[model samples]
Target: MEHFVVSARKYRPQTFKDVVGQQAITNTLQNAIENNHLAQALLFTGPRGVGKTTCARILAKMINSDGSEATSEEDFAFNIFELDAASNNSVDDIRNLTDQVRIPPQVGKYKVYIIDEVHMLSQAAFNAFLKTLEEPPKHCIFILATTEKHKIIPTILSRCQIFDFKRISVKDAKEYLKYIADEQGIQAEDDALHIIAQKADGAMRDALSIFDRVVSFSGKNLTRQAVTENLNVLDYETYFTSTDLILQNKIPELLLQFNSTLSKGFDGHHYISGLASHFRDLLVCKNPSTIELLEVGEQTKVIYQEQAQLASQEFLLKGIQLANDCDLKYKTSKNQRLLVELCLMQLASITFDGEKKNSKHFIIPPSYFKSKGVAPIPVQRPDTISEQPQEPISKEPVTEIKEVPEEVQKPVIEEVVSTPEPVINLSITKPSKSSSGLSLSSIKKKKEHLIKQMDVIIDEEELPKDDFTEEQMVSVWNEYAQRLDKKGEKIMASILQMDVPKLRDNKICIELSNSTLKVELERAQYPLMKYLRKSLNNYDIVLDITVNEEIEKKYAFTTQEKYEKLKEKNPNIELLKKTFGLDI
Candidate 1:
């Protein structure tokens, strides 16, 4: 039996050319070595598993091997020295290294020292190593590698040439993993490799580790399902199914899907976040230029593009927002499951208009009842008597409404607006009739009458316009601001209170303190302008808003500012501060 070795260690890059996802850095080093322009001290820094230490080792070997690959690790043992700075980060360890640097190499013309995680060195040790780095012996080279470049002192950094390593891209990592799988004679799916690459997050070492683990679990055959199962990753199929349910406004189905996911031990927060990503991917696929941004398997991407076609850009954007909001609120929500379920319901209703005007702020579509038809639960309006004079109050047959599916009835809701009638204020109790007693013909007549009345109400014409003075406009503006304040729009009210509108020709020009206020006012421009026009009796009152970028800066709100203000009021305050040695 052979001893087991992880793929990360077994396939570590042995040559500069063998290194993946670092062409620029590797090419620069290769050119320097070829031209004999190698810096005595070189610093390689970047995130972990991005080939910092690996490159350091490769560079050390290549320099001593005359820019050729060494046949074996033992061949460079005499000339190459490696130190773990994490454990040996002390002045004494550095002194010993400095002593070793003075000795001439026996086998090669140059001697190399590779220090891993060099930033782990203390300030004193770094200072001690500085002199040797700045001016080393003629035949000695120093290669320092670290994941954190900021921790290293500037003095040491100035004396060395820096090489920043970037994370291996998903494409490059996938290719490398495929190459490894091919070499191992294992059959691997592209989606499986893509998932592993994404899971690695730009780290080749992590990717290889994941690949080995997956291979061990599933033998030599790898599939998307196997990888997802082993890694506990949320399946893309789940998202696709959920999106279909949402597009159909199937609230019950979406909630069931969420419940199924939760049953698999996936966190609610994770599920919601994944849902947001799924929507984002769909949105990205909607554009040609942005399609490349969608990171998924080729087959999965095709599915995404297909799903993207089913959803409008507006629906995708709103779905993403609702999912993100659910994710953000999932943590603090008292009923975590309910929060996610509500977000799912909102997503299911993204394209729905079943909710009434009273609950317009809420994103809830009609709740589907299994017992009733597919139509959303309709909210009953309070009955009111008409003020119009009639011959007499007649007893009429109640109307019976047909059960229509919500999707089929959505258009009717958009086309019909309920008309308000004056209440009779009758206190007398009346016997109630059952829905079964109502006739369909009577219901049809009542609906027709309601629609006709709504049409008449909507077709009503505006009053004739009359010119008004600037004083009247100002009064209306103030009144509008008061109305906004009453509606709990304090920010908008404050903005309106800050500036008075000026009548320039026929246009009403309003200046705001900042662009934020300007945007808010512009968003509500139609309604605000309509109210002002109605109150001032001017139909042609055009609103023009301008943002003043050079708004006056306000005083600081810190305790230091308060202390400084106090100091200016009394000279004795400074003396007291000096006596007490207070920190301000």
Candidate 2:
């Protein structure tokens, strides 16, 4: 059997028209040759496997072939000189090349020198080659290729014609692969070729190599399933199924699917990152103009559009955010699997009701009334039993109590029972202490009358007026600060502790350090004033707060000022600074 050659070397482009994804550069070079406007030195810079060296060789052959198409590589072997600078990067190597440049071409009109990885040349070598590059022989042409143009000195760049080659696009690579498959009589699917293109990441050589590997593994027929299995890539159906389950709020199914995926030795972070990308693709499909941005096969694109119709824009955006956040936190979390599960739960519950339930407080029992010897007297209705004594129901509303007279105040409780027609409201009060032979019904009537009388007295009561001293006001102010501290308001407590209350014109004035303190004190003014009045028996007390600007002026202006202050507090600081010879 004859030796087998790899696809990368066997299928390399020979003519300018055959180069993929580099039309602009090829067109420029060809036009320059056809018009006889070729430069002495040319620099080709770009990523690897982008047809830089190949273009250099093709240009060299075309210059000697009178701009004619040269399909065979052996046509220009005599005039073309290829150098690997990675091995021969020294002053001697450059000296030998410059010596060769002085001689004329034997087989062609011009000699083309092609240097690969030219950035690897030593500084002395580059210096030695600069003179020849600036003004070369009339019969010599230099072509330098490098992946890193920045490493080349500016002097070298300014002396040559520069051409930047871009990476091969996926569309171009996939079409080239299809042509090759047809030539080889192999059956292939669109999705299988697309996978190979994506795996190449804009490198034509890499794509061809991957295509050859898959063919060797899956025989003559190339299928999507075979490509995915061979490359160990997660299937597109995995992401589609996961998204459908999340949209339907099927948490259990999603978890089981994730578990199954993990069992196959796939990383959780990769899965989540892929999920985020899937969401991004869905968002792109949301708009008709952006549909082309999604890079997938035709069938996969249709599936994405159908799913994008079901997923709301807000849901898709939020899902992307959640997945990205989970991916970032996955490496730091101790329980990685639990974190992912929790994220899934939160995503599923995003549309749940957010209004929390309010806790209900139970009412105090009626045993207090019974313990005070007060029984609830029930007013009999016509439909009720006639055996119990009939008590007349009072038709008055209950009022707030102030002070009840001894003559009418009685310990009596009324129980309201539901009758066939109407519900009677009742009142319960303290019972009488004397043996006055008062029945339950009469005591209930007296309690009701006294409750109304007390309301009238309270409405007519007078307000109290008292005076508090400065010391008493300061004492109560500090007490309030302690209370705030106990309630976990440390900043408020610190504000109060740092300021003191002053007496002015029969009123209390509160002094604070800054505006922040003033605002905090203002929020609690009402409650604090109420507490002070009840404590000091002075309801007419007044408080005025002002920020003292003079106090804030005492702060340090610079490091020197702070050091001086420290020196005043500790004289040994000066001695320490002098010993260390410190400067401000």
Candidate 3:
């Protein structure tokens, strides 16, 4: 049996030339070394395992390099001082480092001090090293390395020339890993390395660590399956297949895919999230410039490319939106699976502009009216038959109201509805209320002509006239409505829009088509009535609200809906079978 070193340590870089994915920082350092324009202190900061400490070590070895690795005895002593701040983080240790700072280097011209995790140093240690750091010995150079640069004090930061190391990009990381694997003559797949790079999450050392593990699991030969299975990753195949089903409207196949993934222990949320990320990748792949930034195995990339090629730009756009919305709604959702399933179903049905079932409050188009076969009807006044003349000389509404006999009414009332919880008959697309058989114009005439005659005579005998114009009074009314609206009085705002106001027999009458609007308007009558009478110089005014018919727009059911209801009432004598073994 042979013991193998992990790739993280085995393939570690020894010089600035060998450092990966930090060309900007390395180039700057090489330039500084070549020009001999190095600062007294250098700070290296970035994410974990991205070559901070390795670069510091390389810098130390290079600056302290002697004639030979074997012959120079002084190379062992003052050439490099590597300190781990995590362990030696006290004031005494820093004081000792400061004391040793005065000595000139024996082997190299300059002694380099590299402090790893420098942010771990105590406050007292930082304070002790402040002066020595700002003004170190002529023979000494300082290099501080940290994963979190923000934790380091600003005073210390000012003394050093900072170099920020970036995360190893997926492309660079994949390429480097391939180079290493090929050099070792290891059989590996490009997708395997790509997975390792993605899992590395911008850290070179982490990438190498994952590479080492995969190599062990795969022995001398590497396969894409080994990498995905070992890493517990759900491949792009599931996403591609599911999305295809959704796009083709194959909901059964979509659910089958979901059930299989769930049975494999993939969570509903993770599955949805992966679906979201997959759609996002497709979106990115559709664009030329951003495609390079996407992280995926070669096979996955190919799959994405194929989908991107086949899918319309609009399909990808809306699919991504639905997936993202599902992801956001997943946490708080009670039926999470259904939520994801519904999103998938909607995504499958989504056309470029989406299906245009009328939105709530969305007006019906002319085409819809034409399809429903609705025509404008003339308004008719109520008429009585000559035989019913002795019934009454009533001037009330004339709509036919059915009267229920007492014996038959109880069961009808009892059977009207019965449920454990009250069911609210609300509509997402239905117009709220049906129009009453009344007209606004008729109501306005009765208001202005009749109310004005009686109120004008009484107004002259009341308080002073010419105090306020009708518009000013309306503005006052509107202001009151505005104030009420700011206090979450939306109903008041709706009532204010009714707008018709008239005075009859020294009383103010306001006509509203909506009963709810009328109720809300009546609530404001006490304060508004007082304000109006005071402002109008007419104390003989009372506020009255009546329902107006003109604004009461009809709420009609669609032809399809009406047909469905009629069919439900009688049902089909025979079971109607639809396509694909489904009966509707």
Best candidate according to lDDT: 1
lDDT of each: 0.82, 0.81, 0.75
What ranking emerges by lDDT with the best candidate at the front? 1, 2, 3
**Rank by TM-score, descending?**
1, 2, 3
lDDT of 1: 0.82
Model 3 Cα shift for residue 121 (angstroms): 1.5
The stretch of ten residues in a row with the least summed lDDT in candidate 3 is 423-432
lDDT of 2 by residue, 441-497 (tens): 456777686445431212212446577777888898889889989999898788777
- Cα lDDT for residue 544, candidate 1: 90
Better of 1 and 2 by TM-score: 1
lDDT of 1 by residue, 1-584 (tens): 99999999999998877899999999999899889999899999888788887888777777777544466655566788889999999999999999989989888778998899899999999999988899999999989999889999999999999988999999999999999999999999999999999999989999999999999999999999999999999989999999999998788778888999999999999988998999999999999899999888898899999999999999899888888888888889999999988888777766765433233235543323342363332222335434556454346743334566657565644443342432222121233242211233445665676445431211123545678888888998999999999999998788887778898877999877677878888888888888987787777668998977555334225787888889889979999989999777
TM-scores for candidates 1 onward, in order: 0.66, 0.63, 0.61
